[model samples]
Target: MPRYFTDEHEWIDVEGDTATVGITDYAQGQLGDIVFVELPRVGSEVARGKDAAVVESVKAASDVYAPITGEVTEANGALEDDPALVNSSPEDQGWFFKLTIANKSELDGLMDAAAYKSFCDSL
Candidate 1:
């Protein structure tokens, strides 16, 4: 799978035409302890750069954006009860949702791991 990062701090791991979405480790670290998550419903169409979910932490609530336009295929139900998984494992079990990619071309606009690391380092 190939992973990409968005400027809004979201990550997408592409596998075939579906992509798994989540907040970056950096984002989780900045959010402190996560307490709640509001997920988008399956079958909902999300536009690139639009708000798709909400993650609330002890510090503040943050919007999770769609890295690319697509239909939400599934959401991580585990997050509803254990939002702290985002802090402990943002890239794996903490993934927010999966989407069937609408346009593969949109991915070219996102950053690869190297570029994303540089972008994060600059901040």
Candidate 2:
């Protein structure tokens, strides 16, 4: 019911057995200007806590990891043409993918909003 975020600054919204995943606003801010995004193919299998994609920004390149084991069901192809959306809306329209969650138990290892906020502050 609540959003979760990783120490690396990726965020996820889990609903039922599915999850919507993306980089956080802070991540985009740290990355500066996003220029390119390399996303996983739909249907690709992703392991829990593994790198599943890469976002290349003007400042640097960062990998996006799977919040939990899952299959990529959808990718935001819109980023191909307009990566700036990530800078403007990291939590909304900039979402990178929709995953068909495969290892729900892995969610337990993820940080809830409050924890994530503290984690963000630590960075």
Candidate 3:
């Protein structure tokens, strides 16, 4: 899997034409304790840079943007029961959704792990 990051702090792990999406660990850390997540409905169309989900934490509610345009295939059901997973395992089990990518070219504009780290460092 090739992982990419958005300036907005979202991460996507691409595998074939399907990709899994989530907020970066840095995002979870900044949000404090997560309380709820409003995931995009499966089969819904998502546009790159558009809001795909919402995460609510003790500090505030934040939109989770789509890193690439696609049709959502799955949304993490675990978040409904344990939103804190976004805090505990943000890069792994805390994943938000999976989608069938609509445009692979959009990935070229995203940052790789090292670049993302540098971007976060500069912030």
Candidate 4:
């Protein structure tokens, strides 16, 4: 699966119309130790660049923005029980939600792995 990232440090992996969304490893590091995750409800509509979830860490709470417009299909329940999964496996098991993409074109504005890496390095 190809992964895309946003300036806000959210990463999204898309397969067909379904997408898995999460914060990048860099994001978790900045947030410190994660304590809680507030997820969006299934079937909720989300617009690109808008808040879809909130991650609370020892440092502060931060919004996880939707990288593409879509209706949420699922939220990661595992985080509710072990929010620290975000710190340990941010790009894998720590994913926040899945969405059924509403517009494929929205992806064009996002950065690919190479671009995102450079974006992070410049930060």
Question: Which candidate should be chosen as best, given TM-score against the real structure?
Answer: 3
Across 1-123, the per-residue lDDT of candidate 4 in tens digits comes to 989999999998999999999999999999999999999999899998888899898878888888889999999999999999999999999999999999898888889999999999999
| Location of the lowest summed lDDT over 10 successive residues in candidate 2 | 101-110
TM-score of each: 0.97, 0.92, 0.98, 0.96
lDDT of 4 at 88: 99
Candidate with better lDDT, 1 vs 3: 3
Q: Write the per-residue lDDT of candidate 2 for residues 7-86, one digit (tens) a residue.
A: 77889898887899998888888888899999899999988668898989887888887767888999998888898899
Misplaced by over 4 Å in model 1 are none
lDDT of 4 at 91: 94
| TM-score of model number 1 | 0.97
How many clashes show up per model?
0, 0, 0, 0
Error of 3 at 26 (Å): 0.6
Top candidate on lDDT is 3
Q: Which stretches of candidate 3 lie over 4 Å from their true place?
A: none
Model 2 TM-score, 2 decimals = 0.92
Between prediction 3 and prediction 4, the one with superior lDDT is 3
- As a whole number from 0 to 100, the lDDT of residue 107 in candidate 4 is 86
Q: Write the per-residue lDDT of candidate 3 for residues 40-74, one digit (tens) a residue.
A: 99999999989999999987888888989999999
Clashes of 3: 0
lDDT of each: 0.94, 0.86, 0.95, 0.92
